[model samples]
Target: MDVDLPYRLELISDLPGHDERAWQVAWNPTKPLLASCSADKSVRMYSYRPSDHGSKSLAFSHMGTIPTGHTKTVRSIAWAPSGKTLATGSFDSNVGIWEREDVSDSEDAGETAGDWECMTLLEGHETECKSVGYSSSGTLLASCSRDKTVWIWEVKPDADFECMGVLMEHSQDVKCVAWHPSEEILASASYDDTIKLYIDDPSEDWFCFSTLSGHKSTVWSLSWSPQGSYLASSSDDLTIRIWKRVEEHEWKSVLELRGHERSIYSISWGVGKGASENLGWLTTTGGDGKINVWEITEMQHTKDPLSATLIARISGAHDVNDVNSVSWCPRLEHPDLLATAGDDGSVKVWRVVPS
Candidate 1:
């Protein structure tokens, strides 16, 4: 736990265009692409190419943009694991499913290429949908909203989706929902200051398997370790809590990371070089307009006063605006890269290379 940072974080480039705050930025799981949503009611996509060896930044070119279709702010965007579809949640209280039409097969390949079509809209959420995520298997999508509910949808062929379950378990606004990296288990964070884990039963019904409660204020986001053994949650309580599965249907708080002076908005776990078992690094963004890199060790979790060490920090990471979200590029080609969105309406790309 006491070592120099193995990686050096360098701000590479910024993508700016949104007229309002950018709420979320997500990296495509299978492609060199990034998608971002904003309060300006649009979703933008950028394709990344590695820069020259000695260049200080990565290269990301604007591919295209989905029209301003959402009547209100677009809060979240998620790409299916297959890289063929996208789901976006908005303040308009609706969810949009977008698919790329196969335009390359046309006789005139130049005219119809790169066509993205809105396949369908899911309109069941009664309030602003805060987040949307597809399960790792790509067969299910989960969405949570201010209406205090989480909805699971079954993905059918040809963009057909069926609402499988409506989980009305949270007592306050449901802020974010995330699927486990390797399982169908779903986790939702809420304004009630709790995170609930759910799984589908043999009857095809989703049920709460466990509730993680420690944050003293609203739980804003949840992220699972790449190995699927631990869960991390950020909260308005200004702390990030790590939970370990101790037994079947049970989880225990293993570490409480306190550093940010204000509400912690987002957290993401990434693969690190020489990552020990249940030990690695993570990045956190918050209302304080700072980004922090933390090192978590499983050995520390076994000791009293378990905690993670802050390895590095960037003050004013977003030019005095809250960093709303941070995501590590999951593809193998760019494992050391991170993308962040901020209230300043920009998406930044940062490279974390071994120092």
Candidate 2:
């Protein structure tokens, strides 16, 4: 993890496609493939090669084009770890998984001239599909909707899929859902003001393992610690809460990260090695135009979290714009980098310099 040094936002490149907002941007875990989605009803992948020379064109490698299907707006996008498939959720209440195929491969690894086809259109969620994610193993895909339920699907080895289960517990729209890195346990945050953790079962009895309560307002974002021991959530309450599973199903609030004065939009864990350190560090963005980095400490993780310290923070980040999403780059061999998007219809990459 980087030391307590404030990150300097370097304007690597600006992608302006969405007229209203760039809803989500996903970076492929394999190469430097970057995919961005927007309300303009388009998803474009960018390949930025440091070795390439040019101002307008060579700076970006536009890979497979994602066909926009939703009627209203494209809200979310997630790339499979294999970097071959992408899952997208939209305001149209539809979830589409686009699989990339090799059409005319010129040569080499970096050269990919292929087209994307929407192989699967999942139909179950009743309202706007806000969030979606591929499981740790990429075999399971989970999505949350405005209908207050979490749906999990089992992707077969034969490239087809089946509806595994629907987790019903939250009282309001399920805003966010995340899966543990090594286990099948799922955590979901909702506008219902609570976060519920669920475990899968063959008996169809999906019960809550723990109910996390701390946010004074709607919880919009939830993330599992890469190792699965800690959980982090951001809310309209203007604060981020951290929870830990001390025992089996018994979880406790460990940290209340308060830096953003406005509603927090998204949260993501730092990339580390094992389940313990995969997300040992954390970062977040908010409507206050600020970006903050936090170190999940052992002392603040013991019930009294107010004593925790802020590691790094960048104020007036997107100036007068609401920061929509924060993400730790998955090509995590270089673990100190992060990618962020905002309502200003721009994406910026940050290098968390270790001091």
| lDDT winner | 1
TM-score of each: 0.92, 0.88
Q: List the residue pairs that clash in candidate 1.
A: none
| Superposed Cα deviation of residue 354, candidate 2 (Å) | 4.9
Cα deviation of 18 in candidate 1 (Å)? Answer: 0.8
Write the residue-wise lDDT of candidate 2 on 278-311 in tens digits. 2356888889878887766455355464334456
Task: State each candidate's clash count.
Answer: 0, 2
The best candidate in terms of TM-score: 1
Span of 10 residues, lowest total lDDT, candidate 1: 103-112
Q: Over 4 Å off in model 2, which ranges? A: 1-7, 52-60, 103-111, 272-279, 300-308
- lDDT for each residue of candidate 1 in 268-298, tens digit (9 for 90 to 100): 9887544555356688998998888877666
Ten-residue segment with the worst summed lDDT in candidate 2?
A: 271-280
> CA shift at 177, candidate 2, in angstroms?
0.6
